[model samples]
Target: MSDGTLRLLLPRFLRRFPADLAAIVLLVLATGVATLAPVISETPLRVVLGLVFALFAPGYAFIAALFPERGPAFDGASASATADEDERSGSNLVERDESADAHTGLTERADPRRAGSIDGIERVALSFGLSIAITPLIGLVLNFTPFGIRLVPIVLSIGGFTLLASAVAALRRQALPVEERFEVPYRAWVGAARAELFEPETRLDAVLNVVLVVSLLLAVSSVGYAVMVPKSGESFSEFYLLTENESGALVADDYPQNFTVGQSQPLTIGIGNHEHEQAEYSVVAELQRVSIRNNSTTVRERQELDRFSRTVPANESANWTHDVTPSMTGERLRLVYLLYRGSPPAEPTIENAYRETHLWVNVSS
Candidate 1:
């Protein structure tokens, strides 16, 4: 686009101007990504991104709401000429409102300058506080629903709300005269900061700039180090179990409280390889009486119930069906699934166990 065309599109020197339709398309895509990326990626990542969106999205939406019309901020020198030209053209809706207000005895509201300019550090602080306030209120509302502040629901709700606000912002901006809309002043800020950051007026200012840069670099490096470095010898493997109902739905709660001496209860067992390498696993399912006292557990009278083996690839998972039928009945008995590396150990202890999980099961006649 020509510089003149671009200048007219974005009235403010701070806002960046893009082709009209393209800007809209980009906003839509960004909103979609912010909302739906969690579905494609991991749940943890989705939650993190959702939190980020919650923090910033509300402020943006609030800013847009503040200036639904967003009339350009006018300077004294050029405004009178533009005003007279608008008067001559008979095209200023805002001007007509002033005339109507005079007849109706209602005060006319002028459009916000620089199209609802939120350009200063103080405005930023206010917006951030407002966003923090808005986010929890929304979460409070969602807490009442079945979604219960989950990643997908929160992301979609906030993302959709932000999208609506953005559309309204875009519509208002588009409705404005070419010389009255805001631009995304990226290039302007880049040039200004680069040129001005080091060129301080005094020695103290120069020292302050250097200190700020150093502090920023230190913060960034700390975060980088945290992300890139592993915790000292930290390694883990994930193992889990799930029980299924007759309808093949996973049963997360209300497990059967009573089982007959010879009746079978089926469950699915999964092992995840997160130890950073492939490993063959020998698993044992045992029935035992477990006693816990003073933050310690003691297993006694343990009976071997079942045995199985599997090879799992690194950073992957393997799951299978296992059936348990009580050979003996007892009160507050335990069903333990013990995992060991390679060959089965002579016995399974928590120390030798790569991973283990158990259920507090009861058997009755």
Candidate 2:
């Protein structure tokens, strides 16, 4: 092409090239950011980065398309008039020479900016669609694994950012000239997508809507499962007492009421659960003596109960007996019972579920 024709076309070509290049570059960068989302985010930072990339990259791409340089294409006479005017006004000849050079490519070919603008729009649309699809799948995977719960916040943050960025970019693009603005087609595509993928007449509030619905469903299901499942095999409300006497009673004063008595009394403790689910439990039992020497006080004496360490099934109970003896006289005896709704204690120790009952007897002073 002649120098004059080249100068005329150069401004438009230079303006269009950056827009096309930026669109392609932005899409590539956005994809890379998404791919690294899982790796980079130990917490919400991953989502933040993803969102930043997702919004800004495409937006800048659209901006690049919209702001292409448009230079004035002066005709021969106007160009000469400008030079003559510059000379008369004492402006340097350099200005005339540069203007002449600037108009060199006026007639080289038809504008290629149109094709660049169209390509930029298509590129942005494709990037947006791909991101929307991939992000949800990422969320789903994170939800199922042990690490899934942690990813929830990240997903939410990224999703929010994505929506905001897209909206802002679309608005900015809309303000540009029709040929320069890629956002119009993008918004149209988003509208069509909403109709095709979401409920009719419902607002297509992108990430927020999807995240809220999914989170609510998951929370409800979790609560339902917890309520429907029986928590323990051993019933927390019922306990059994089997005294050395066939009548389930221990004579408080038959032997020494304190440690002095060598005789051991056999007693059994049991717990039952009516629910159909098996439950693991921690069981506790204590033997206490009531005294009235100065005032009434209860003393819990250590007793050997061997059967408190196992899980009981639904409608089932474990019964075991231990021999307990009193060390002093005049002490009124009692047995305490406790049934736990969780795992059995790792070692024998006192727990909180015990119930207490007394057995009275006459003691010789």
Candidate 3:
């Protein structure tokens, strides 16, 4: 029923250290930042910041907990008096000079169960474990939520670790006696760590750290590689005829008059790369034409030249147009494209490249 018992039952933060209540504030800030990340970033920078903040949250909590100030119970005169009484009791033993030394030794030796609490280390380890477990779960849940696409679990993990570190720092600052709180223990821990570095027993921890670091680096680099490299063998090419009037039409007027019948006329050319790869040159086209000739014996011809030159990259397409006029004098005429492939000057083979029109054109004498 005493205040001391009541204090022990309540959370440390509720009992004291209200002014150093920065951890909660930081948690709120990080949450807000993460929520607004999609709005703020055209790139994924907001997501990156959100992840960083998530990692920082626990650390922030730890640090806030570590702020230097003795709690009210520990700072009071009653605690000091208790220490003085204990010292006086020790002094009394020397004055008696009986087998008191032996008796004191017996009592001290008997009280082997008086080891100090490992509560601080336990709390830190518990916090670390909880942070690691919960953050990933939260992140996974967030991913299923509407905004989850932007908020990944890795970011959440970062935030969780940050919060954990902050909490440890804060607990260290607040729990231990002034002289023994951080400095001495930290130095001792450091010395032990240095010694352990050379110890064979510590190799497992080192190996685990290395594995984690490597995995993280690999994941990050994989994302970067995906963003930078083009996909292979993916391209598109399209060609459409643009008439002189801007209407989508292909007519004899669309091409030079000197373009001879039977000789290829360039039509619209288009190239596209759908794969994440580059093509030195590729072409695709859409063609339209009307052929006219007065004499039935006149030769009617439509050919596409192989001279056009261009390049296409993965996942993209281009378009170009060419016109053809028939030299044949024929009452009825058909329009089509003679497709060619390969480098120019040398004849390019046209296997199935021709697109013949179903409609017949009437030639006027």
Candidate 4:
């Protein structure tokens, strides 16, 4: 950009507070992470980042919605009294300077406290509290929608709502004149804080001193633990079934959707163990009527079609080439491969599953 453009742009952007800029970046990043799933394939990273966005972004926006203007002083009687006192002092300082000076009557600066709207500390704390309270409600609402609280939908929806709230806040703030703008009195607040730190005047001061010390220690310990703690390499398992077709050899899962009752279907079941240890596994294949109602799956007439067992080591894989056939035909039937860590049970459910996958088949009468 040209020098003229830079000069024009700097002041406008600089007027935005650090928190506001942070909110903007977070909102954009949240949406980006949700939309670009392939680019950020690491599930853990996505989950952590998503959590950060949820905890901070909406809360920050909610704070903005409530307190659009940020300035030196807070509202209420104490703040009003402080403002009046500061204004008087500034006036007196100006008067004395003007009378003493030969020229340029305005020698002393105006009081910074008069420019503020709320307590910065209180605003920050309140925002965090509100975010925690509001996030679950937002999730509840998302549950009813088609998205159903998945990564992409939740992130995008929350990010959009947060941005909208922030925009409303900025608009409300802009309604006021620039001179009367409510803003955090950064310099005055910092100076007062530092001065109080050096000379404690109240009992609260002593308590705060202890709190700060403890907080510092905790912060350091948390960082050290994160750095030194041993990581258990990824523990997981993968299972799938495959069958051949006339087109070529094919994965039954990805290709064939139709099946026949009492017709022996030649299929290969494969399991890859990344459980990071030697373990025994059980596979209970079932033909059941699976129906989803009100976000819950209802299984009925579960017929155990096949059962298999194997003990596999870490990073090892096992495969079984066998035939599986359904003895019953019904609408909305599923050929479910329920994989468990131990011996096969009389009945199988996902709750005790180490890994599970399914094949939806159209069983013709």
For candidate 4, write residues 129-178 as lDDT tens digits: 87787788888999998678776676677777777777777766677555
For each candidate, the alpha-carbon lDDT, in order, equals 0.67, 0.49, 0.47, 0.69
Query: Pairs clashing in candidate 1?
Result: 14-185, 15-183, 15-184, 15-185, 16-183, 16-184, 16-185, 73-113, 73-114
Better of 1 and 2 by TM-score: 1
lDDT of 2 by residue, 1-365 (tens): 88567656767634343333434445444545544566643334434445645444444434433443221222232355555776797865466787545544543232224333334444556556655565565567667765664434544444444444544454454565643343223444587667655754555565656877799999978866654453545534456565445465543324323333556565555556565557666665545455446775645444533335556776666666656554444445554455567644444333334433334432223
Please give, for residues 51-127, the per-residue lDDT of candidate 1 as tens digits: 55667666655565565332332333244555677579777566588765563352122333553355444344665
Clashes of each: 9, 29, 66, 9
Best by TM-score: 1
**lDDT ranking from best candidate downward:** 4, 1, 2, 3
Ranked by TM-score, the better of candidates 1 and 3 is: 1
Q: What TM-score goes with each of the models?
A: 0.55, 0.26, 0.29, 0.49
Pairwise TM-score winner, candidates 2 and 4: 4
Q: Global CA lDDT of candidate 4, please?
A: 0.69
* Candidate 2 residue spans exceeding 4 A from truth: 1-236, 243-260, 291-307, 343-351, 354-365
